[model samples]
Target: MKLYPIEAGNFKLDGGAMFGVVPKTIWNKTNPADSNNLIDIAARCLLIEDGNRLILIDTGMGDKQSEKFFGYYSLWGDHSIEKSLARHGFSKDDITDVFMTHLHFDHCGGSIQWNKDKTGYEPAFKNAKFWTNENHWEWATKPNAREKASFLQENLLPMQESGQLHFIQNPDSDFQQSSELGFGIYYVNGHTEKMMIPYINYNGKTIAYAADLIPTAGHIPVNYVMGYDTRPLLTMPEKNKFLTDALQKDFYIVLEHDAHNQIITVEQTERGIRLKETFTCDDIF
Candidate 1:
């Protein structure tokens, strides 16, 4: 099995919104904000080449939204999905599975793209079977007002329309049940709802994809929950449990939103679980 980091693109978001109640005085040190108080974030996706299956973990925000709509996020950086894939000697058609952690635009937008004449949306990975949880699908499709903007129809509906959408909830499914997942599914409802964090068994090491649960390394602080969370209170317990387990198991947490650091390890300190070390994913190899 081979895993590669795919750099889809980057975008800017309000630092305050990303860090919730965490004071700017704290988070700003690590994720320095621009004059507009926006923090640059990476839409880093993971590609897994396991035998005959080429699975892509997430798709960055695609270039289908109107300029006016994209004006809000301020997408930046030169890294693109196509360029990143080419570097790995692959293309969208080579992806057999597109495993979405959730249906948020930044995470799944690249899964679908606008047709040539702007007639309609189409699957970005023509040969990939789009994978998502049943619970998250319903939550994104009939999103509440708070999360409606993040779950755009243009980025989601096309997966099902193309007859390539599949849910991963069957008990017989071993994606999460096998030791290959490293730590297995640690589903938490605090972030959005049933956000699936993949705990990968890479060689002798254990790494976890810390989706929005811990957006950045600065967010390692227990209280730095995102305001975008549906239930911030619930996030605390979930994070505490996750951190405890991660620290106990000596796991490398792969941050999906952090621009500078790609992976982080935790340690048990007087202040509870704190970052032990930081490094790029390639350093592990």
Candidate 2:
């Protein structure tokens, strides 16, 4: 199987919000903020070319949102899924599977787009089957007040409406050795309900698509949970356990939201699991 790190786009977000209660005095050391207190963020999506199935994990924030809506996030960059795919000699139609870790706007927004007539939205990738778990679908569709903003109806609904939406079967354990998608999936609820982290074996190395579960290497510290997480208390334990397992299993964690530090491996230290090494997709795949 071949792997590609698709640069869907880049934007800036409040460092405080990204790091949660962790004071900027601390997080700023690693994820330094700009004068406006905004830090660089990347919508680093992943593309998997396994046989004929070209699977894309997380679609990033699409360009469909209004300028006023996007201004809230400080959108910046020339990157887009279309441009990124072309960089690797592919296009939207080439994708066969879109495996979203969750339905948060930034992760799955690119899955749908404004139709040619502009009367309504439609599935962005015409040939791809959008994938998410049934539990997550329900959670996102019927979002709570705290998360309502992240789950936009225009970004969703269209995929299901297009008849191309599919769900991976839920497993008894939070961690699944292998799903029908042919990879290990680690399901966790702290970030959102039933977010799936794919443990893909590419060229004999395990690549864990650590979405919001461990957004950045800076979040390696168990308590460095994002402010956006529904259950920060639950996130602490879930993150700690995931980090411990990552060090033991030697998983190359792909940070979906980390703008600069894309992939990293963990090492057990006296302070608990910490980043052992950082790598770009080119260095690993």
Candidate 3:
């Protein structure tokens, strides 16, 4: 199996929102903010090429939103999914599966795109089966007031409309291996209901896609949870358990939202789980 780091694009989010309750004096040291107090955010997606299947994890926010809509996020950077795919000599059509960690716009927005006629939306990966759990599918589709803004209908619905959406059954178990995808789905609810973090076995190492649960190396500390999380109190314990297991099992974390640091490992320090080492996908894989 081969893994490629796909750079969808970059945007800026409020640093305060990214690191909830964590003082700017602390988080700013790792993820420095701009003059507007916005921190750099990456829509980093992962592409796995195994035998006949090319699975993509998390399609970054697509370029379908209006300029006014995108201005809210302060979108930046020229890196795109097409350019990144071409770098690996592949295209959207080659993707057989799109494993969404969650339905947040930044994470799964790129799953659909505007059709050629500009009449309606269509599945961006024409040949890929979009993978999401039943719980999350419902949670996103019938979003609560707090998370309604993040779960855009344009980013979803089209996959189901195109008859390419598939739900991972019974995703309540922790680290349950999906028979078809051949990856362990680590379910966490603090960030969102049933966010499926894919754990892949590669080269004698377990590489975990650290979706929003552990978005960046800076978020290694259990307390450094995102304010956007629906339940901040629940996030603390969930992060603690995940970090403890990650340290014990020697799992490499593949960061999805960290713009600068791509992958990281944690150590059980006296203070708590802390960042051990940071590296790129090429350095390790």
* Residue-level lDDT tens digits of model 1 in 1-90: 777889989889999999988889988998899999999899888887888888888898988888998899888879888999999899
Model 1's alpha-carbon lDDT is 0.85
Instruction: Name the TM-score of candidate 1.
Output: 0.95
| Model 2 lDDT per residue over 1-285, tens place | 999999999999889999999999999999999999999999999999989989999999998999999998898879999999999999999999999999999999999999999999999999999989999999999999999999999988999999999989878998886555788898999999999999898877899989999887788899898999999999898888788888888989999888889999999888888989999999999
What C-alpha lDDT values do all the predictions have?
0.85, 0.91, 0.91
TM per model?
Answer: 0.95, 0.98, 0.98
Report RMSD (Å) for each prediction in the order shown: 2.3, 0.9, 0.9
For each of the candidates, give the backbone clash count.
0, 0, 0
Q: What's the lDDT of the predicted structure labeled candidate 2?
A: 0.91
> Residue 239: error of model 1 in Å?
1.1
Model 2 vs truth, CA RMSD: 0.9
